[model samples]
Target: MIDKSNQQSFQRLRLNLRQLEVFVATARGGSTRAAADRIARSQSAASTSLADLEAALGVELFDRIGRRLLLNESGRALLPKAQALIDQAADVQALFTDEYAAPLRVAASFTIGEYLLPSLVAQWTQLHPKSQIQLRIGNTSEVVAAVAGLDVDVGFIEGAQTHSDLVTRPWLADEMVIVAAPTHPLAGRLATAGQLADATWVLREHGSGTRQIADEWLLKHLGQVRVGFELGSTEAIKRVVAASDGLGCLSRHAVTQSVADGHLVELQTRLPKATRKLAIVLHREKRLGHATRDFLAHCSGVKQ
Candidate 1:
């Protein structure tokens, strides 16, 4: 027991989830009425909640223009903190239920998301049957952007793509292969740089991690080459290359099944081997909850 007079006084917290939730919804929806609809509250109630939050913080979180509410610098600063607190509170509530945990939000680039994560996610779900995952698939640029923006809990990306706001951990090693139809002249033969350079290629789009690496590898030896088609999907590139005389550079994992099925043949070339490191990325400021941490541990096991 300490003396009552010596005890330090602390300020009582005026912030509440209701106010934060209202504020977040309003920020996302851009209007109080829109927030009301989103959170299933009356327009007046949403407006009141937003007003209370602003008053408690003693600063206007939003800038008013006509009927719209746009986040100012202060509001932008507070948004991620508010979202984290809400997720943590939900995690606490979920502990008492039969559910495994709060939903894990993940974004992944094309190769990992399509060829890799399905089996890993299925394995994770088997161990924790009630777990929920929301996975968004895009290219590495989008994955990096998603993690940097705090739009997802974590991201998996291919190649050396990175962001200053993200911490990248090398998660797996992957190889790239050049592929073409079996009937193509380069099939089953070691080709010179001139033969490779003269070939028309079908490759991924400009923003893709695969394209970045492919360009680095190809441009270094082959110089300028003709692009027959630029596609967004790895599968689309595989199919187009298999049907036409055009060649493709893609992940070995992405083209393995097609190569096995005789739909596409791996080309032997004199160019140096292409290999890349796939990485797990997270925002520097993100606070990992238990579910996210556990999932990361599960991912680490794959390298073993």
Candidate 2:
């Protein structure tokens, strides 16, 4: 004999997707604010959902010490089950609703994430009002890895290269430009090879598409430049470049506002137009489900 009493205790239990989502986010974030940001939910809503989950489970999923919430033993045990349920439920819902109910998991590199995907996601939401979009933003390599790891349904990357295991299709055209603070010396005139090579450059960290492109295009034109800093964030690089004499190479889209605001200046260069095609990639091993296919078709239509 088994313990029927334990099973009977949950006879009246009702657990919704929102609660599971909140729980999983809370666990992954280790803080309510990060979790709320991740899921795009209001802090109050996140907190309430977490509280509701704890109440329903009759156990505290997290231990509150000071303002921080740490997952306790019970939470550790429940996290995997909650994640599995969420993933399985999303798939099942897609099957039943012909993909309308399917949740979308999208990953994008920094340039696309900051400049493009938000608008695209807004447009996507307009068409499928009930669609749930979960987006992850990272560097190009990270986006490719996410696709390979099956962490995302689709990935957008601006790298000149992609993983062999992914199907790649060019999505958009992007131009990389060199930028500096308004007061920098090279901002107003064409930069000499020596000046370009001698200047301090704040560039993206290795494994980033922007950095790879710069390495391939800019570095060859101007001999090795002095690396002032290596940062993982494009926004941070922009801010740093705008605040100092350090020059940075970034997508033109990223520096548009800064240049217009007189905070950053787009530098003139003699090098061939450093343009690259932004690409959408899908894992070779995964067949496109209806939700994925629909999103792909939408991208194609929108681009066309």
Candidate 3:
């Protein structure tokens, strides 16, 4: 006869570390084959491990979507808890085994990620050699969502977010400048609001912070602005502006090198200066890691 307490412990042990590992890998990799490659296991082993995990949990974690596996609702619900458990386990191990903790995970929008953060990250990593720094770069909205959802420790975005779940602090000011190639007809002319409206405009994709500010500014002054093309990346937008007659609005940081090299010319406009508040955002309730806090201090000018 099995002892009652022993039975409960045995049942709990079924959802063991191996199961957690497989589940996490599958969730992240989105397929058994990919998870197997990530964990250095055979595809059959990964599939068996996932089957064991689902059986132990008594819940279907993923649904097959064509050839790929996607997290089902239960898997989606379990993801954060599983991640937190793993993070906590790593933290506990660090407490006992490691001399220093792991590096901070930080996310930021593309403009800052590409131009501003590399130097800052390098400087911070140099100052603390044992500390690791990981960065995730996305559009402004994606960064905000990541921070809000606790997918990233913190994020920097070039626009204001009104979400109540996030605490946003203004870190810096950024400006969007209208630009075109030197050969474009508007290159030398001081463009009036109406003339600016008449020109073909290449714009950033919808979710970009730069696009939001540009839209608001254009709507207010030009009554309505029509976009001739929508490109997903600043680099692509710059290329389009450089090779064509279309005008583009881009962060000053993004186009600085081009402007200096004279590949792109800033279009002087009668419109008011378009400024945006770059903000550091984090969840209101999350406790930030020491490395994250240190980086935030550096960004806020509270530290060197």
Candidate 4:
């Protein structure tokens, strides 16, 4: 047990908020390079911060396994504490600032970010002109991590993937539709597994909620389909698929506009389950901020 009463022992500690922030980033990213990108730091600088943190605490936070950095027991235990510190710091930063002006930090997975959140946020902001919203978009894994780390007030994720630290509520239903360019061979007809296998499939990068569902559907039906390219954004994938012979699995919501604009064609393939529920995610222990709760309520089907 750490003794808070020991003034001499407390004086010897050299840890600071930056080191804690670095530790949390590394844990969330699972690698020094990814952590550096998340925190906007150089790889060497992030590594040095981690090293300093470990030395100050007299314990190794991450287990070095080949090129991957896995959080060891110590690292896992320290994560929540670090997250709490970061959240508290944000609270302190907002203390004297106008509450309405403080941005309602929202994290969302690609599908929701591209299709739904913008319009929803826009509508809400018209009602509360002073309210501000900042949307951070990432994959399911990243959004879950951000919510668990208290980096965002709320998150919306597609599919049934749930996190232990988040309270998930079924928000909306989304359909996964396979699409292609109007000029492609599979454009207006039913495509078989062999036909789809022959064409290039442009997919979202790994860890995306849409990608996770798409991978399962492809593995079961298309068996070892070739991915021509992996992209980070739903809009980017839709544009690429509209211009190339590549097939893309994306949210129906995401591709609806493109299909209507005569740029893309929806393929009729037998999918195991084309449907999944989008969930509202929030840290189990974190209280919802006023603006965030209002948006969340809107998503949950409340007329307000």
Task: Give the range of the ten consecutive residues with the poorest summed lDDT in model 4.
Answer: 295-304
Q: Estimate each model's TM-score.
A: 0.69, 0.68, 0.68, 0.65
| lDDT computed for candidate 2 | 0.87
Number of clashing residue pairs in every model?
A: 0, 0, 1, 0
Once superposed on the true structure, which residue ranges of model 1 sit more than 4 Å away at CA?
1-92, 95-99
Candidate 3 residue spans exceeding 4 A from truth: 1-100, 302-304
lDDT-based ranking: 1, 2, 4, 3
User: lDDT by residue for model 4 over 17-76, one digit each (tens)?
Assistant: 889988999899988889899999999999999999999999999899988899999998
Better of 1 and 4 by lDDT: 1
Query: What range of 10 consecutive residues in model 2 has the weakest lDDT sum?
Result: 93-102
Local accuracy of candidate 2 as per-residue lDDT tens digits, 6-33: 7886776677889999999988888888
State how far residue 138 of model 1 sits from its true place (Å): 0.3
RMSD of 3: 13.9
lDDT by residue for model 1 over 43-71, one digit each (tens)?
99999999999998999999999988999
